[model samples]
Target: MSLFKRAAVSEFASNASVVFSTLIIIWLSIVLVRLLGEAANGTIGADVVLGLTGLTTIAALPTVLAAAVFIGVLTTVSRSYRESEMVVWFTSGLSLLSWIRPALRIAVPAAIVVGLLTIFASPWSHRQIQEYRARFELRSAISQVTTGEFLELEHGARVILVEANENDPEKLGQVFVRIKDDPWHSVVVSDHAKTEVAPNGDRFLVLEEGMRYDLTPGGLVTRLWDFDEFAVRLDSKDAEQTLRQSREHALLNHKGRPTGLLLTDGKSHSDGQLMWRLAIPIATINLALLAIPMGAVNPRAGRSFDMLVAGLIALLYFNLINLSHSWINNQTLPFGVGVWLVHLVFLSLTVFLFWHRVRVRAPKNPSD
Candidate 1:
């Protein structure tokens, strides 16, 4: 490596680290705030919130890294130009295109990391997140029931209230249940009931010495029954393992499947995902190169101008990528054109900018 290339690479990397860290910290703070509400609502546990945030951050790292590289190169080159250091390099016959070498040195590694995250780590994290949500949903339905408070379950299909004996979790002294089913309304009052899980793993509230009154909805018909003991299932499904298929496979799982499998699946959704994973890394490189010329700044002007422009470009690039994913999924655009076209357009833009920068004459300082 040339001395100039090594110095440029080091400078870009140093700037990138600072920018990347700041962005991640800011992003994490915003995410934590959004998740805190869910934690309070019991939708997610406090411990799980942090884990989920970390996983989400991992999933988001590719775009973050891409933005970092773009801003890094832009800041480095813009600073050099603002301070008139670029004039010295240009006079020394280093063309504007030379920035690609140093930018790539930093970008190639970032791109590889992005690839690993998009292809493998991100998908795995997504699967973990789905599993966490499924477990929480299943448990929340039962856990919301509290003694001494009337609780509505299954969107008010049933209502139950229990008054338990002092210092006993299982011994309830009074139980009331209101059940509303089509064409029937029933109320039950029990002297005492014990909460138990049956041998077959069914959850039941077994009532002793209970009287049940039934009324036909909107009718004069009524019935009453006295029972020594009766049991009602607490959960709609028996208290046994209920297997649920995951929805994460619709997006992330396809990345882990063999490329051939995706091709054979004959699903547009799978094709869209496969294209997305492959495109992210390529986008990283294109954005990196594009950042070099975009980062160039006038020595007299402040660094903020180039930074703003770089941000806009990054925004547009990512939006286009996301739009492409949707287009492919909807079959509005062919996968071949939808996925790679965005990268190609940006890559061409980068090349044109580099060429224009090379042709444009640099202003001279007479003192030099």
Candidate 2:
């Protein structure tokens, strides 16, 4: 309840909010522009681009919070040293290690938010993104009909392949199809094709100048027929929904799993991902504490060397965490030994630096 402690905590919280907000704005702008480009190229639907970008930003909050904590602590401490306030505190018995109390107050809440995002919100966001992509692919397959790709229709019972377009957008350059519905299997190849619509709103791909191969299920009979024209109707909306659900079910992976589920399952990749998620908040706290000792500065210097050093430490810390994830997933490192090693290493380093800062200070002359 000391004035110094209250003032320091408030200052750090304020600085972190300002810095975190600014970094979020910048990161979102860059991510949004890239995501919008994906939308334009048909990688994702235009309608969901902004929503996806928002989810993407939410998933990235840990990185932003970490950076904000680093800068907040560094800025707070370096400014103290530069203005000679640290000298006053050092003389009055406030050691450099004492900075941890206030720094932690900000770090704890930030860590909790990071954990929530990483554990729950992130998975939900990724799941939504995947569903949006699946829905777009389904709608685009029937509505837009891009060339040079195979479009699966009717729960894998029928497949339609389109080759590169030849000039007229309304006309398909070349079409190939294979259909297997219970007792019969057939192959159809066409010189060119185009889409036609009936009065009832049913859409069909009309093939021109084609050959058909028809076979019985028992291989007892086979026939080849030359046809001047043929028609394959696109699936109805209900059929499309079935296909979409099938695709969604197939794509359920670790990225879409909640943290609680991942914790219980403990598969190699899932465990690794969960550890990394937990590490973000832990890493933020570690880096903030580390920055206290790292951020001692000479005000006369042209640039803030302490700030740069803190940044380098953070960069190295994150890279090591990434490396540890790979090692754990590959079975080179034990799961129990993965992320904690990084934390312990940096924690020791922070403690050492803080101890050195305290020990290296000169004794105050009692006469003064």
Candidate 3:
């Protein structure tokens, strides 16, 4: 390789590393904060925070890497222009188009990484996230109880307090529960408690050798009873509703499905997902090339305008990619067309910009 190409590739690599690190740090901070908030609210267990954070970061790598490569190419070229290095290269018979090779050297590899992530690793991470949530949801409210702390379930309609059994960490001892049933309030005190799943798939908290007291509001009536075993249904209406909302909130559907499955399905929704997965890697290459033209700026002029324009173009590129997904899924656009239309448009823009730059600002020939 020529010295110019070597220098360009080296600079691109360094800049991309800086950008990738910065973006990953920012992304991780945001994800960790959100996951910690969810953990605090009991939406997810605190123990799984790190696991989820890692998986979430894996799922986000493609977007972060794409931005890194794009910005790397843009900044590298723009700096060359600012430093008069481009003028030197142009005067030596190298055109603006010469940058494409070095830019692609950085871009093509990054695009492959993005492709692998989107097509395989990302979906696997999403699937693992869903599995984590599904397992958490399968646990009964009674099983969520932490000894020495009062636990509220079904929106505070039921409250439980239990002490740990020293001999068996999994067993609960000295269990007390208060249930508010509007017209009547019931309280139960039990020696020990365990969770049992009925044959019909309902969960119940089985209180052993317990005393039950039922009292009316304002002490209008009171009844007391003793029993060897008492069962309290854990699948309350409010709990079920909460579970449904949680499921819907985390539902990835096609996003979490394997690529092989997506290909075989051949449905519009699956096609839409396929479009998005394929678009990310394609955009990585297109945006890197597009930045070559965008990076051409006058040394005498302010950079704010150029930066703004470049940002808008990149934004529009991704937004249109997203829009194409919606259109394909809705059947408003055919899969074949929707997948290529946005990419072709940007590629055409890249080619036109290169041509204009070469024609309008072509270096003067020494013979002329």
Candidate 4:
């Protein structure tokens, strides 16, 4: 390649790397905070938080790649103009079209990475996320119990509280339990509670030195039982089976389904998902094209105005992509119409800007 093309490509790649790194760090920080919150709320396991965060970052890669490529093109080209390098290129018989070659070099690799992410890696990561959540929810209720927290299980039919753990976290101390059903209320207090998993995989919370009090609705009498040990099964067999079925059904959710499945399926949500994946690569190139013209700043005035316009355009395009996906998914717009409209519009704008920059800016004949 020519030295000029080589230098341009080098600058574009460097800028993309810097922008990509910054965006990833910011995005990962936000995702980690949210995942930690989920772990703390007992919605997910603390042990799986890092794994989930990594998967989330993978799922977010395509958008980050697209924006980085966009900004990289914009910044590199704007810097060239600001430094009068474009003037040098123009004086040497090079036109705005010469920028396309270097931009394409960067865009092609970026788009390929985006295609891999959106087509294969992203869907897989999303499935992992779903499985993590499903398993976390399906774990035996006793396993989710933490010291000094009130936990409700069996659809709020029973509540368990552990005031402290004496020897080990697995062995609870000063426990309180409450059970409420149709016409009865039961409360139990124990000196300590420990969990035992039976040979059949059934889990029981065994309370030691506990007294149980049972009160029936509209009855003046209450029954009390005092025992050295008490055992209660944590979850019914039916609930486990139901949870398995729900998780199986979740595979059909948009995030859980693979890109290949989404491509073949005719459902609106699936089509929207598949289209959005395909759109990323195309939009990446189109945005790079848009930025070339946007990067052409009036050397007299500050280049900030040009940068402001580019930022607005990039933001507007990003939001439109999302809005179009929602509209297509909800059947408010036809799939083909909704998916391609934003890209086509921006691509057309890019073409017009390039034409104006190349033709209108050319020196006119003195006679004319």
Candidate 5:
């Protein structure tokens, strides 16, 4: 490789590393905070926060790496222009268009990695995340209860307290349950309690030798009853339904579905998802090449102006990709047309910028 190519590729790699590292840190921070909030609210368990954070990061890497490559190319090229390196290259018979070769050297490999990540790794990560949540959902509420602590269920609508039975490890002693049913409040005290699973998969809390009291809100009415065995049904049906919905939603969710499955699926939403996955690699290459021409600026001009324009262009390119996905999903745009339209537009712009920059650098005729 030539010195120029070597230096440019090395510098692009370094800049991308820095940017990728920074972006990953920011992404992890955001995911952690959100997961922690969910844990606190009992939406998810604290134990799975780190696992979900890791999986979430994996799922987001393709977009993050695309942004990194775009910024890295822009920074490397703009710095070259800013520091007068472009003048040296120009004097040596290297036109602005020559940057494309080195830019692609970095971009092509990065795009391949992004492609693999988006197509395979991302979906796997999303699947893992979904499984984590599904397993948590499938856990019975009674399984989370401790012997000595008061466990509240249904947002404190029902409160239960129990003691451990030394004779029977699986049984609970001195069980107390308080239920608030709006107009009526009931309390139950039992000598011992245990869980029973019916043949149909429903769970019940079986309280032995219990006394129950029902009280009215105004204290005008009271009822008492004694029982040898009291059974409280727990809704296994609701849990089963939740588990079913989660699986269905996962199939419906494009991000969680594998690329192979997506290809086989005939749904328009799946096609939109497939387009998005395919577009990431293409966008990575386009944005990297586009940065070359966008980064050409007058050395004497304000540095921020060129950077601002480049940022806006990158933003627009990504937004258009998202818009294309939306259009395909909504059936407003055909998949074939939507997939390449935005990319072709930016590619043409890239070609135009290269031509315009080369023309501006061309020497004038002595007669004109």
Candidate 6:
């Protein structure tokens, strides 16, 4: 509420916004590059790529926000020292702890946003990603076959090539197929081939006037047969219709399941997921606290030192959280302990740093 506090908050917010935007753009750029490659390979569609990237960005927002807040506070405080702003404030009886009030003012709202993203938005995004992948995989088998190119299907069980026939997309004037099943290796070549859909909608590639050759994997003898009609299974409509279960059974659901459901779920994995969702928001707050002291830099030493330290601390904090999550899932660490211990450690560190900064003597003023 005071003029100094207002000015400090405004300064911190501005710096945080710039840092956050820069980091997000950089992160998104890397993700987009990878996603584009996958799309081109037919692993995913353009729409699905966009959806996945957008959701991943939402999932990553908390960490980005925490980093931004840390850098923002660090820049603001470090600059204050460099420009003698802190000297004026110190002369007026303000202490380092005075920074917390303004930092918290910015951080509290950020923490709320992180909570919503982790608990609500992230889960929904994950579900959408899973659904998109499921649909893509089911349709991928048939969509992969291209004219004038040899196609490997069913883990290389069959290889087929269609040559020529511009008038018909599903018809080929010349067709060759090799089916390798270890003991019995069969090769089929046909003068003409066409695709047909049964009433049940299953697809089959029908070959006309084709000759088949079969040879055992390690046999000197080979068998040959002449056939007028040969049918090869083209696509499994049934497989496409059967929905696969999603990999995302985490406590957070797109529809926003109550935290209690996650806590009480019988599955240990769910408990681990639940804890992760809850921990993200708490981590945001702790990171904010940690930032206050981590950002305290001596202007003479340069602005980069505090930023480097902040980056290291952030990296360590997130790594510890990941390790704790694994431990909880494995039952090596109790859910109660693993979930909160990492947070408590960082929180204690923050408190100690805050105390140290406040108690330490300010740099002695130079004789004017």
TM-score of 1: 0.82
Please provide, for model 2 over 117-232, each residue's C-alpha lDDT reduced to its tens digit, 9 standing for 90 to 100: 87887778777777767766555354544566677877878899887666877788789999996578999999788887766556688889999999987778888989999989
* Every model's TM-score: 0.82, 0.74, 0.81, 0.92, 0.82, 0.82
Q: How accurate locally is residue 289 in candidate 2, as Cα lDDT from 0 to 100?
A: 88
TM-score of 6: 0.82
Error of 4 at 176 (Å): 0.9
How high is the CA lDDT of each candidate model?
A: 0.79, 0.81, 0.88, 0.86, 0.89, 0.79
Q: lDDT: which is higher, 2 or 6?
A: 2
- Model 3 quality (TM-score): 0.81
lDDT tens per residue, model 3, 212-310: 999998766999999999988887334455566655544448888789888989899999999999999999999999999999999778878998899
Clashing pairs in 5: none
**Which window of 10 residues has the lowest lDDT sum in candidate 1?**
237-246
Better of 1 and 3 by TM-score: 1
Q: Specify the highest-TM-score model's number.
A: 4
Separate clash counts for every candidate: 1, 0, 0, 0, 0, 0
Per-residue CA lDDT of model 1 for 1-368, tens digit only, reads 88889889999889889989999999999889988878876667666788889988887888888888888888888888888888889899887888888888889999999988887787777767776666555453335455577777668887888886676665787889888876888888897888666666556778899999989977999999999988766764432244245443423466445455666787887778778888888988898899888877777777776678778888998898888888888899898898789998998999898888778687999999
Model 6 bad stretches (over 4 Å): 146-149, 163-174, 180-186, 190-199, 206-231, 239-241, 247-261, 360-368
Alpha-carbon shift of residue 64 in model 1 (angstroms): 1.4
Q: Tens-digit lDDT track for model 5 on 105-216?
A: 9999999999999999998888788878987866656666666788887788888888888888888888999989878999999989998888877777889999999998
